[model samples]
Structures are given as C-alpha cells and as structure tokens.
Target: MNYFIFGGSGFIGTHLVNLLKEKYPDGNIYNLDIRENNHDGKSKYINCDVKQPINLNIVVDQNDIIFNFAAVHTTPGHPNHEYFETNIYGAENVTAFAEKFGIKKILFTSSIAPYGASEEMKSEETLPTPNTPYGISKLVAEKIHMIWQAKKDTERQLTIVRPGVVFGKGENGNFTRLYWGIKKHRFFYPGRKDTIKASIYVKELVNFMLYRIEMDRSDVEIYNCTYEPAFTIEEISDAMMKATDMKRTIYKIPGGVLKFAAGIIGALGGKSFGIHPDRVKKLMISTNISGKKLKESDYQFQYSFEEALKDWYNDNDNLYLE
Candidate 1:
C-alpha cells in the first residue's frame, strides 16, 4: 500500500515514516512537507504545502492511505490566527486531495488540547470545550475529516487519534527539559503532586496507529490516545529519574509561589523566567485523558514511561548530558 504523510518532517511524522518503511518494505511512501525531510532516507520527500492546493503531479494510488499531521501547535509560540489558518486550511486541502485522488482511508493526529486543560479525565464520549485557538483549531480539523467521511459515508475509513504529550527520541521540548533538569539534579515539582501528565511513547503511538490501519476497519473510529494509568507529575519525575539512574533531590515549590512570580512579571511588564503565568496555571491542572478505545483494541502498548525513559537514556544521541 502507498502511504502519503502530510507534515512528514515533524517529530511524529518522522517516526511514522520509519515505521511505515519497516512494515511495508516494498511500498512507496511519500513525505509531503513545506520543509524537506532532514533525517530518514527511506521515504521519498516532496515539497508541498498542505495549506495550499494539492499538486496533481505527486503520484498516488486509490488504495493508498493519507495521514494528516500538519499543524501550528506550539501553544505559546505563534499568534492565535496562525493555528486556525494552518490546521483548518491544511486539513481541508489534504481531504480535498484525497477526494480528488479517490483515496478512501485517512488517519489524523489530533490533540487532547480539544478537551482543554481539565483536572477530570476525558474520554471519546466527552464533549469538547476547546478554549485556546490551538485546541479549537484541532477540533475543527477533526470535524473536517468527519465531514469528508460523511460525504463518502459507506466507503471511507477515518481514524482520529487524539494523542497526549507524545515524547521519545526526537522530542526536545517538554520531556527533554525535564530530563535536563533532572540530570543536573535541580528538578523541582512546579505545582501540585497530583497533577496528571498524560503522555505516550512516540514509538508506541505510531505502532498503535499502524495496527489500526492494518486492521482495515471500515467507517470512523475516534480514540483518545495515551498510555494507560496516567502518571502524576511527581510520579513521572520519579520514574524518569529512577530509569536514568539519577539520584536527584525532588523539591516542591508551592503552586502559589510560581503564580505569584508570574503575576509580578505580568504587572511589571517583565519577561517570564521560562515559566509564563499560563504555563504555571496549567501545571496545577490535570490533562488526564482516557484511552479506553485504544485499550480495547487488539494492539498492546510496547513501552511504558519507564521503558521509554530507558530507551532514551541509553541512546547517546538523545541524552545530551554535559
């Protein structure tokens, strides 16, 4: 089967491409992104923007599957409008391309952000209350896919995966920062100990998606993807530190302290000390999403937080400890 991946240069996309190569050695996989594929050599790279009209020149078979991962998802980085423009427009263009090419299957990676930052555990049945532009835009993108599926009602297969804070080898954001802080033995609990930090190992996430696609289930299936038995911030830090064989002092600074500092910075027009008020606020809440649908599926997750940490810590490339 042919596989076409939009936003194939990003972290998840890169890993998915590798998985595709391993699973379908003879299949032709195309990676379409605004930027060129910088690492993986298995998949062919095509310079195409998902926000623009799809180019007809890129060959695709009707039996091929298209996975859409393009989005502007850096919560605090881009302006609000950028999220809607990239995510919504990108989904539209990709779905249009699929329709025009007679492709019947689409797999999308949406975010748990749609549920917003809540302390309660959310499931697929939960109604979305997306407050931020990134969250709102992702929910809209999911709707766009559903509309396309509805148009093709009986013929199309759509799998919408709402993944939580995916982390692994190429991830250099949140997980990496935490790793560094722990490595230096200065990591502290930023908020309450019970704050849930739902997440998935990138490899496991890609594996589960492939498992679903290979099953060739008809119609639409939506899943909230995260590792089972969500871990608290305290638990995560402990597991990561233990897995890495790091003996560090875990300190807890009351949530109020961070909030107060954030307030002072906001009032004085001073720059945030790597901790914005919004981020500090989020640290106190739990994004405990339920993966009931995925858990019920036939595929078993291969990596837990401990296993994922072991993989990364052992990989010299990933551990950039001085």
Candidate 2:
C-alpha cells in the first residue's frame, strides 16, 4: 500500500504521517507538500504545492490513497481572497491529480467552520450555513472532491472529516493559547464559562480518520469529528488545572466590559493579547458540534478531555512548569 498525503507538513498531516508509519511500516508514505515534514525526518517528502499542478517528479500508483490536508484555514488571519485561492484551487489541483493518476481513495481534513458558529449543537447532517470566507471555501472544496467521487462511482472512496478545533503538542492555535495562559496563571475568560469549545485531540482525530476509511461502508462518509457533549470553557479549565496540579486564578470579565475593551483595541488595530472584537465575539459564541455519526458507527474514543489534558501534561511537563 502507498499513501500520497498533500499538505503533509502541517500539524494534522505530520501526526497522520507518524500514525501511518507506525501502523503500516511496510507502506510507502509520501508527503507531497511544498514544505518538508519537520516532525518526521524519515518521511519521504515530495516537494509539491496544491495551488499549482502537482508534479512530484514521480508516478503515483492507481491504488495509492491521497489525503488532502492543505488549506488556508485560519479565520481572521488571511485575506478573504487567500482562502478561495488556496482552498478551492488546491482542491481542483488535487482532484485533477487524482483523476490523472487513477488514485481510488481520497481522505480530506475539512473544518467544522462550514457549519459556521452555532449556538445549538450541530451534527454531520445539519445544513451547512457557512458565513466566513474560510467556511465557504472549505464547503466548496468538499464539493469539488465529492464531484470526483461521483464521477469515479463505486471505484472511489472519499472520506471527508469536518473536525472542530484540533489540538495537541506543536499546535500553536487556540488550545495552545489556553495552555500557555493557564500555565502562566494569567488565563481568564472574557464572559461566561459555559461557552462551548468543541474540540478533538490530534491523535484521536487522526485515528478516527484511519478507522473510518477501514470500517465505514459508504462510498463517501462525511463525519463531524469532535468529542461528544462538547467541553465548555469551565470544563476545559478544570481539566487543565487538574492535569497540571495547579490552582491558578481564573477570572471572568463581564461581556460588556470585554466588548468595550475590544472596541478600543480594535480601533488601535491591536491583536497581541489574543483579544479583538471578532475573537471576543467568538469566545461568547458556542460551537456545540457532535460526532454522533462516528459514535453510531461503534467507534470508541481513546481519550476524554480530562485524559487528553493529562496526556498532554505528561508530554510537556517541563515546558508547562517552566
């Protein structure tokens, strides 16, 4: 078996490569990414960009599976045009390459952003009402891959995963911010503690993707990948504190006060403290996403939020303590 993973230098991609290598050591795992795989030096890195035509300087076998993890995913980070340029065009390039190479399977890591920010918990079957540029682009990308799957018919297998905030070691996003702030004893919420942070550990999310490919029967199985009964800010705080064995002070500023502060910061064009109007609004909003489809498939999660926190603490105890 051979694996051709696009954007394989990313956080999820890196971990996925590690998982594949460990699971199938005999399988030839090729990372077709513009950047080299920093996490695994043993990985066979093929220099290719998904925005352009992929030319790995080598031929891809028909049975080789492709995993597309490349995209401009960070919201309020990239220009609106960048998302469409990278994500949509990237999808086009990937599917075209797959068609040309006769690759039979494609696994894509899309985001829960397509469902947009919702107060109620959303399932995989929920109507996608994407509001942001990132969200819209991802939805379109999924469609592009689906079109390929439809054209290939029964011969193709397409697994699309819409994961909520995925976090672990080396991922310097929302969760990392929380970890560092909490470690520094400066972690606090801008509003109520009940706001949901629908998330998954990086290892488990990757595990589920591999499992879905092997177990699910559908030609195309789209799953909303995240922990069920999503962890709220309070729960997350409690887990982190317990895991670290630290009794750090957690303050909750009033929403109105936070908005006022964000207004001033926004006027000044400052986003240094991980605070801004948009971020403040995001903190207040609840994204209660469900992974009922995976659960219904009899998939078991290896780690809960608490267990994941402890595992993370164990891995990075020195960094967290220092």
Q: Which lDDT tens digits does candidate 1 get at residues 1-322?
A: 7788889898899899888888788988888898899445788888888889988576678899998998999867799999999999999999999999889999999999999876888999999999899999999999999999999778889999999878887786667767776776544676668889888888888998888877655699998888777788888888887877777787888878877877787678764234456767777888899877787777887877788878767765545521
In model 1, state the lDDT of residue 311.
78
Model 1: how far is 319 from its true place, Å?
Answer: 4.2
Question: How accurate locally, in lDDT, is each candidate?
Answer: 0.83, 0.83
Error of 2 at 18 (Å): 1.0
Q: How many clashes in each structure?
A: 0, 0
